[model samples]
Target: MPLCHLLQFVTSVVSCSPAELKLDNNGKKEKVKGFNVILKDTILFPEGGGQPDDHGTIEDLPVVRVLRQGAEAVHFISSALEEGREVQLKVDWERRFDHMQQHSGQHLITALADKMFGYKTTSWELGRQRSSIELDTASVKPGEMEALEDAVNNRIRDHVPVNVRLLSIDDPDVEKVRSRGLPDDHAGPIRIIDIEGIDTNMCCGTHVSNLSHLQVIKILGTEKGKKNKTNLIFIAGNRVLKYAEKSYNTEKLLTSLLKTGPDEHVDAVDKLQKTVKRLQKSNLTILRDMAVLIAQNFKSQPARGDFFSLHNKDGDNEFMNIIANEIGFQDTIIFLTVGEEKGAGLFLLAGPENVITELGPRVVELLQGKGAGKNGRFQGKANSLAKRAEVEALLQKHSCRRAAGEE
Candidate 1:
């Protein structure tokens, strides 16, 4: 037998202290209006099994929250209550009731899927907004999924009583309990949740007393996973109503924006994507034509090797590089403008390799730019056109000195 089964057997027979219900006044004790009780024992498993803790009033002192520290259960309370004082604890019935409904509903669905289709629930996550369960199955056909949903809902409508029992591990029917998995060291008597003639599993989480509490169970979607695994997203009870409301509003907004019905939104978006692509292509063609015209105008100007200019409205960096390569100069000074505005500029000042080696840093400092090359190329943004001229004059003066062989 498993260690947990042995532990469960021992735990069942042993009469331990009634699970200590901590008052939620930050561990501080205070006076209470009406609170008294000596519980023989409790089945409320303080928050565990991916489910949140139970909330309610203990001895009329509102239990804001219940948390487990090690093996002891601590209840966080708003009102101060004396410690060691007996209190009649009352769980938040609505919340606890809802959880019970959802949990039992989950069991019915998982059991039906396993019995009918041989799918096993491998993992599950109960989140605040939604919940999901991963099943160890390759795929679930649409018809099968619909059938499973209908079957689970039918069980809920049947209003089956959900029975909670403490049973010894050595009990004759222990092996008959068809649970997906049980705790490794489960000892003493295990807490078993059984739905008459439908499902039975060992679980420590609180559950609804009856199936009727679970009003509905709706499968939202499914995603394929590794090997033979698939995740199913679902909502239960009031969550189903909330999801429907949100989805309806979203689709209504999309229909208005696309000037089409909710069903036509996808087609509207596809058409919009094609329109954007066509506009981008047309814009590119216009930019290419403008670049050609600018290059022709620059070629008309006389080149003294002192200054080279090309005005571009599109701020095309590729065009600047093309013009620079064509107008080669031993001592070149290139000044390209981004249209008539003060945008970006590139300056290339190169003398013979030998000349630049000595005065490269000095030229960079004078132009308020920084770069390194054996020849010379300095590219950066300029504040204004006047600053460009000052840089050009400085480069021109330096080039003249080099031409005269005066270092």
Candidate 2:
């Protein structure tokens, strides 16, 4: 009746030749001769649908890359063997096996979500280490997601047979086949992968012969998407084992650093944080007591008219500021202190406002420092205690000049 139906009828009536071709390592057309066998007509689908291409060896030589030329898939060989000679094809059994596990796992996950939540998978991808299927729904609740993950994993453990069948698009059986999506230009016979009792889809990619091949399915996480969609990220098979091993190693390292076992490391961190806070409080209390003692000692000093000096190893900028403020109210007190550590010194000059303005520059010049301000108050650092008397003498001379109105 319809053109598609007529074409399907004709295709069903005739079997198309298998397109697998086995070539020699030298890229020559050949038959089964060496361990490497390139197929003339192959069911192996080169990487598409975000899933990588299959990797294997033909006649023992590795197939490094599989590419598409028009409608044909080409398997590139590694070693250059005899040209124009036929070789036996060998697919990398491990890689092919893993791909099958992940692909089948993806179908189970998508199908379960569609059946339970009405979330149809819009697109899907099989990554190297992980896979994801995007659903038409925007979001799924965490509890609902947990149920979906459990359902899919249960299916993997069910060990259903994964069947691959080629049928014409126009066949009457096509009406009974429900597919997520099929390649639009796949006009002749279509490759359908049926996960018995789970899913049926048009796919050219290799899959495990049975569901038992996928030992496990682990949903790692789900992320939100635009246009009312969600991306389901997951790992399966040997990938799950590898991920668990890595996590175990990381936990071991952390436990060693924390000096605690795996189960206690988190509690150890919390306890250590509280201990640090308590010690910090005790240290602050000691600093405050020291500040008060220093302030009192400065007050007991005899008020001097010319200048006075003190060297303090425990004094810092804040400590010096407190002491200076306490002693500054005196009529004439030029307090100086050498800080305990390197790169520290303090000078506090206070006298008649006019006298300080005149002598401050002279004092700063002698100490090899530079600063200026109003009033008979000047504060700064000296290079060393040896230069303190020299700076004090300069200040005294300037004060005398200001008193004599010669400044």
Candidate 3:
């Protein structure tokens, strides 16, 4: 039997080497320094065969990671242990049992998928939340998935015995077992996982002793995979309960917010979205009409000033453009801004081409903004609309200076 098959063991440290391990924190990569210790034997399984490494403790020190290197399992620990020292090794049983359930569940699903539907499992992953098996087929229909789930759960209810068998590499039984091939440095007897009357595959990951231990398996759904393949997502054992609880909580929150029953959530949200769209359209129409009125009123002034300026706190670039178009930029230097009076907003300057070219850069600087101009129209976003009075003074002073020069 493999030492990993045991949950607790007394072992001697063979060697210790200090090393730095790079880990992904969220989306960031970080490096952590630790000691890689090889033990005379280990109860913690190393990462291999598509299953993650087991986490445990050695003499009360945390064993963070384990990896199989040739015939040895290297345990990465937070602190170094003296070589040849005897230590007590204990596996994190909860995590170990979870892996056992998921690994065994995967075997059952893979075996039955091949047997019943002839869907060969090309690859599989034991993910943190859920596990998946990639089938050679392009897709799995809902009906087929339902049937597959039913079949796997039936076997779980059957309480079938799952046995581990060891055989010589050259044994006839070794050839009968399903295998993806052995690692380059594989040694000792071949380890085979046998699901009585169900499957016999060569795997090094831990597994449950009985099908009943899987508790249950839920086929979540299917997702697109590589060319001509489909990935079937699933959750087994306690994960099924976790997923259900999360889904129910989400449904409850939506029901409360939407003020509708769970069944009516979709329709209620759809109606709310349509109402918002309608209101936005109406608001845009009103803003356009108001812009035209403001322009006409400014034009109606009997004694018109060279510069006409207006600011609408709750307006946008389109609103300012509408006002400028209605007033006509031929004669008056129109400085229209739409946004907060003392905060961020947008501004448009339209008049003489020479004036636009000269004043555009100044206006952008005063407004703490960025803008572009062509012909006689300049427009851009403004970050400091509070400085509008200073911009007005500058425009007035420049206009007066130009008029006097013309005279």
User: Which candidate achieves the best TM-score against the true structure?
Assistant: 3
lDDT of 1: 0.63
Model 3 misplaced stretches (Cα beyond 4 Å):
1-5, 279-407
- In model 1, state the lDDT of residue 227: 73
**TM-score of each model, paired residue for residue:** 0.58, 0.55, 0.74
**lDDT (C-alpha, whole model) for all candidates:** 0.63, 0.66, 0.90
lDDT per residue, candidate 1, 1-407, as tens digits?
Answer: 32211111101111212233444377697543322222333333467666777666555655555555444555555454444444455556656655665676677878898887888888676766677788898788768888888888888899988888888878877678866566564445778889888888878776767777678999877888767799877778877887899999999898888989987899999999999999978876776666666545666677654555555555555556556555554555555555444433444444455655655565456545555665444344443443555555665677677567786
Which candidate do you rate higher for TM-score, 2 or 3? 3
The candidate 1 region of ten consecutive residues with least summed lDDT is 4-13
Better of 2 and 3 by lDDT: 3
**Sorted on TM-score, highest at the top, how do the candidates line up?**
3, 1, 2
Question: C-alpha displacement of 34 in model 2, angstroms?
Answer: 20
Task: Tell me the tens digit of each residue's lDDT in model 2 across 56-116.
Answer: 5555656655765546566665444454445555556567667777877787887898899
- Model 1: how far is 120 from its true place, Å? 1.6
- Candidate 3 lDDT, tens digit per residue, 345-391? 89999988888889999999999999999888999999989899999
Provide the global lDDT of candidate 2 against the true structure. Answer: 0.66
